[model samples]
Target: MSTPELQWFKSSYSSSNEPGDCVEVATTPTAVHIRDSKTPRTAQLKITPSAWARFLTTLPT
Candidate 1:
């Protein structure tokens, strides 16, 4: 099945000048998508909203 195009964005913590250190994210009602900014066409990770929420809890604020 073909996937629809998603609107991707990077975190504010990611510096535009340091493209190599950036990660991009896209979200839908059912899932969240993550990909390396430097290689967008490469493999991407997809997770459910609940999983994404749990992941956020593990990160330092």
Candidate 2:
């Protein structure tokens, strides 16, 4: 079986000058996927879009 491709994007908050420290994201209608920018081939964390929204709400200012 062949693995499907996903479009990943690094967080805008991540400094552009340093490409090493960032988290990549890929979103679909069903879920939001995340992975370390330093390691793209590894397993990504998959979460529902609602869950992702809730998570972001908890971020400290």
Candidate 3:
């Protein structure tokens, strides 16, 4: 999808030192935008806020 208007934000946990495997996120009124930090200009995977929350909760700390 064309995400020309989404204001993307990188995870605060991301470190410049660890450049690889980083992800960027954008929050819209209806959905969340997720993209690779290494390739910010590429297409993003959009999901609902509830789905995003569920996905995050499944991550191991």
Candidate 4:
């Protein structure tokens, strides 16, 4: 089986003034994908949903 193409979107927190300094994300049933918005065709990072949640908790709000 093959996975479908990911639907990437820029981060909500991305500054409109700094378009090149942004990140994009896509979510699948098993993993979350992250990549630089300026370089979508480059390599991306993948992590489990649970791991993503843990990472979010570590961020300062």
Candidate 5:
């Protein structure tokens, strides 16, 4: 019916010096939710756990 409420937290990678440029994450057993901290009301993306893993692997170290 409806999605369960998730506890959101800001990413540590978001530099404290740049509070305006940040992202928030909310995780569930089935998917991960991502949203912009600056404009959260605009849109959000949900990705499967596997897809999230693949995306993470592509990021620079």
Candidate 6:
């Protein structure tokens, strides 16, 4: 299957001008996608709904 085309965006909390440390994220209907900005050709990590919520909860409010 071909890779899905998505509008990748960096997290608002991210503060990196260099692409090496940049992470790009995109949202899909059933998952949240995360990929290294420097390696777009590599595989992306997909997080489930519940896990995504918990991950956000761990972040500072």
**What is the clash count for each candidate, in the order shown?**
0, 0, 0, 0, 0, 0
User: In candidate 4, where is summed lDDT lowest over 10 consecutive residues?
Assistant: 3-12
Which stretches of candidate 1 lie above 4 Å from their native place?
A: 1-3
Summarize candidate 5's per-residue lDDT along 1-61 as a digit string, tens digits.
Answer: 9967888889778798988798898889999999998998779999999898998899999
- What is candidate 2's lDDT per residue for 1-61, written digit by digit as tens? 9757889998778998999898899998899999999998988999999999999999996
Positional deviation of residue 49's Cα in model 1 after best superposition, in angstroms? 0.6
TM-score of each: 0.87, 0.85, 0.79, 0.87, 0.83, 0.71
Off by over 4 Å in 5: 1-3
Each prediction's Cα lDDT score? Answer: 0.93, 0.91, 0.86, 0.91, 0.88, 0.83
Candidate 2 overall lDDT versus native:
0.91
lDDT of 3: 0.86
Top candidate on lDDT is: 1
Off by over 4 Å in 2: 1-4
Poorest 10 consecutive residues by lDDT, candidate 3:
2-11
Instruction: Put the candidates in TM-score order, highest first.
Output: 1, 4, 2, 5, 3, 6
- In candidate 3 the C-alpha lDDT for residue 57 amounts to 100
RMSD of every candidate to native, in Å, equals 1.7, 2.1, 3.1, 1.3, 1.6, 2.6
TM-score for predicted model 3 compared with the true structure: 0.79
Q: Estimate, for each residue in 1-54, the C-alpha lDDT of model 6 and write its tens digit.
A: 897788889877676666477888888888888899889879999998778889
Candidate 3 local lDDT, residue 44: 80
